[model samples]
Target: MAQRLLLRRFLASVISRKPPQGRWAPLISRALQTPPHSPGDLTVTSSQARPLYTTRVCSTTFNIQDGPPDFQDRVVNSETPVVVDFHAQWCGPCKILGPRLEKVVAKQHGKVVRAKVDIDDHTDLAIEYEVSAVPTVLAIKNGDVVDKFVGIKDEDPLEAFMKKLIA
Candidate 1:
């Protein structure tokens, strides 16, 4: 009971003190002066501006096995060069090489993008590209195949390959 009375007295004294007047006082007052709104009205804060996930978000690499049409759009028609990775689930070398290639490609920033295709999932693309083996990486530019390599490559080889593609 004593603590509660003391706290109340302290709060009352603090409340009686006026805040310092400044140039921002009018803006603060205006922001605090919210008018009546309907239930459908929406309010957004800077923290809630962007979504956690968005389709247009850029990434170093993405899967292209779902839609071949979109693959053509992203790779062939792209203004930037694209690296096409043809791999399969059962291919041991592919598992080792995919992430390494993505890491190397990321260093290029927006100069290049990677479109990964699972040979098992997209057999048509594999056959169309004449991919006879797994871990076949192709560098494409201006809708044409520029450079290619088959099998797993180490970090140095991968970096060199990406450098050639951007050049």
Candidate 2:
């Protein structure tokens, strides 16, 4: 009796939906038509199997290396608004926020430039800015920090703040 009940439920489920026929027909036909290749036919070597790091996008290549000796001259003295991201390598929130900040920079490519400062590497700069968090984004205009955000922030608010500052 239990087996019959299970079979009836299975039949109902099968009848309720159209079976995938046309979409899977070609794949099923191909699998039946092709003969399986032998191991010897495959020529992939260990070196070929493991691909080297290539085609790195500009965004992924971003790293927080030692800042220029005249960091202030480059960032604070810039004509356009400079958005400095103070982050550390070990911080999980920083990792997540880093890519989002990059998108914000790409969105405002000409109007603003983004720079990263590793608090672990440049402790002085972090101390100078009074940054006490992992992911802190500071918008600097005319060498003064006009706006700052700690932790993950919505893109709209950040964009609006930047637009107002730029205007």
Candidate 3:
């Protein structure tokens, strides 16, 4: 009798066709895929391998994927000062410097942005930028190279250098 009553109640609820309410509503809607979800599909596939430092492939924080045109568009033409890090995968100093530079850049907030260029991926850009070394950093402002350093600088010196660029 209780089972029958429960079945009848469930049938009545389904027949009413009213929208789900409260906490479980979202889970149910998501499971059914009946209602539209905004922000599109936020799913990452196994085939897509993101970097260890960043979650998304295209991140806005410090590491940027700037090709020839993107480099100009985002770094060179920007109102804010830009620090272009020219590096390679096999470089030891670059691996060390990349994170350290990012930490300092984060302290500056919106004042500065870092664009990383993989020399192996974009050999043309490396040659154009005249990056003979693995860890070459360039500071750009007003569409020109204002300052630059070609080595793995410690946190203090790098921070000081960054300050000079923004100042």
Candidate 4:
């Protein structure tokens, strides 16, 4: 039953929707059709993967999906500064960074928003932002990309990063 559901999702993503166009259209299109194999490709698939971190921060943290419209509404249009985390389900470092990012965002007590973007589900976002790797965090303000970083960061750095964004 699970396998069938997974197949449905895969087909819907690939067949029903049209590919986004832009400078990265060709690359994104190719990637969608021929996704690269993960290190444990045989044992794990992107659909089967779940986030290792699950701490909630008072609706301040939300997942961004459905391409440009969603991102524009949640992140770009948000009154508060947005910390956009571009990560993949199968990424190891992302699992560690996600919770920590949430924790730091929560400290602000709604001053900032944490927007999680699954690179696999929103390749156009990743490509638009020039994200070449997983676990990239961007600080956005008033629909503009203000700051960004890649890879996992410790609590102290994460705190400082948030501070800078809000400041």
Top candidate on lDDT is 4
By TM-score, the candidates rank as 4, 1, 3, 2
Which ranges of candidate 2 are over 4 A from the true structure? Answer: 1-68
Q: Please write out the lDDT profile of model 3 over residues 1-167, one tens digit for every residue.
A: 34533443443344334676787877645543423335763432223323233343433355446578887788878898988999889999999999999889888866888888889988888898898988999999988999999988899999999889989
Could you tell me every candidate's TM-score relative to the true structure? 0.65, 0.59, 0.63, 0.65
**Residue lDDT tens for model 2, 1-167:** 34533443444343323443677756544422324457655332223222224453444123446565556766778797788889988999888888777776777756777778898888988899999987998888889989888998767776786686677
Point out the higher-scoring one by lDDT: 2 or 3. 3
| Model 3 alpha-carbon miss at residue 8, Å | 24
For model 4 the local lDDT of residue 125 reads 91
RMSD to the hidden true structure, all candidates: 11.7, 14.4, 12.4, 18.2
Whole-model lDDT values for every prediction: 0.78, 0.69, 0.76, 0.82
Q: Among all windows of ten consecutive residues in candidate 2, which has the lowest summed lDDT?
A: 43-52
* Model 4 misplacement above 4 A: 1-57
**Candidate 1, pairs of clashing residues:** none
- Name the lDDT value of residue 62 in candidate 3: 50
Error of 2 at 26 (Å): 49
